[model samples]
Each structure stands twice: as structure tokens, then as C-alpha cells.
Target: AEVCYVGVTSSAPSSVARTPEQFTQKLDAFAQKRADVHGQPVSTHTIVSPDPIADLDDDLIKAIKEVGADLVVMPTHPPKNLDVIMPSHGGKVATHTNVSVFLVRPRDG
Candidate 1:
């Protein structure tokens, strides 16, 4: 079983708009789904940082390393014009971190 650390960066306004509990629940559900599919127990640590793209890559890197993550997974919303390209921050973290990164595209209805 591998432990997972889910990091989310939100601006002040966004944070104010959403509750941490709500965010954590969503992440927990995600982790649980992965665990179910893998048939392995997985634990998750949800973090609400101010903004990894703006203020906290070093800290994020350290935390991810400390948690012994096998990979970092993030949701990316690419611009409509460049939907084929991954988000910039996804590239930045993938380039900067030692761990592998998986960028999941947002689901469309």
C-alpha cells in the first residue's frame, strides 16, 4: 500500500469560497476510488496551500518527498485553445520534482 499526499493551491478568494472540509472530502473520495481499483490500501493527506504556482514549490516538494510519494497527481484545466497541452504548473512540478507526475484532465459531461 502506498500513501498519497494531495496538494491543492487556491487563491484567497477561492479558499474563501470553498470550505476545506469540502475539498478534503472530494480528495478522500478520489483516493478511495483509486484504492478500490488497485485493491490496495491507500492513505491520503490533503493539503490546502495558499498557491503552489505562486508561493510554495519548495515547501510542496519537501512535503511530497517527506511523504514518500511514488507519484504526484494533479488535475489540469488547459486552455480551450491548447487542450492538448498539459497545464504549465504541471510541467513545472514534473520538471522540478524527483517523483513522477500524473496530470489528469478534467472530466467533461
Candidate 2:
């Protein structure tokens, strides 16, 4: 079945405490739940990788293709300002990957 892949890049050492398999499973469960609610079929794969800011686009594309992902969904942190051209890992991935990508903006409080 075609699956969705979520790539999470973090610089925090503590974030690496969880195994990749564990993280993937959790994401799968969450996706399953949402799919179930919507009466749709969906599968998820999660990749936890260290930040590759210099070549983040390459890293994300590699991960997405490795999982045979049909689509990618990512969340962005709040932007500091309108003029600020904040570097985005998601943006990089979107620009580089061949597959479709969806960037979900964070809710403003």
C-alpha cells in the first residue's frame, strides 16, 4: 500500500534517546487512529535523523525515498517575523523531493 512518511530532524541529543523503530511505530499508530476516524486507509513511517542543515534537503529526500513514500507531511515552527526568511527544513525537503509534500503551519495562539 502507498504510505506517508514523516521525517523529523532534531538537533537535541535527548531526542535521539528513542529508537527509530519506536518513533516510527508511534507515528504509525497515530496515523492509523486518524485514518480510522476518517474511514480512510493510511500508513505512516517516521525517520528521526540528526539535523543536516547544510544539506537538509538531500537528507530528507533520501529518507522519503527510502520509505517508498507517496507523500510527506511536515509541521513548521512559528516564524519570528514576516520579513524573516527563516530557513525551513520542510521547505528544503519540499524543494528537493520528487514526491508530493504538505507543510502544515502551526496554529497561532
Tens digit of per-residue lDDT, candidate 1, span 1-109: 5757465545343543376667777778888898888888877665566665555555566667778877887777756655356336667678778889888987787
Candidate 2 lDDT tens digits, 23-56: 6666778788877777777766454557645555
Error of 2 at 43 (Å): 1.9
* Per-residue error (Å), model 1, residue 45: 2.0
Q: What is the TM-score of each candidate against the true structure?
A: 0.56, 0.61
**True-vs-predicted CA distance for residue 69, candidate 1, Å:** 1.7
What stretches of model 2 exceed 4 Å from their correct place?
1-3, 7-17, 48-57, 68-70, 81-86
Cα displacement (angstroms), candidate 1, residue 73, comes to 4.0
Which pairs clash (backbone N, Cα, C closer than 3 Å) in model 1? Answer: none
Q: RMSD in angstroms, candidate 1?
A: 4.7
lDDT scores for all predictions?
A: 0.68, 0.65
Q: What is the lDDT of residue 76 in candidate 1?
A: 72
- Superposed by TM-score, candidate 2 places the C-alpha of residue 89 at a distance from the truth, in angstroms, of 1.2
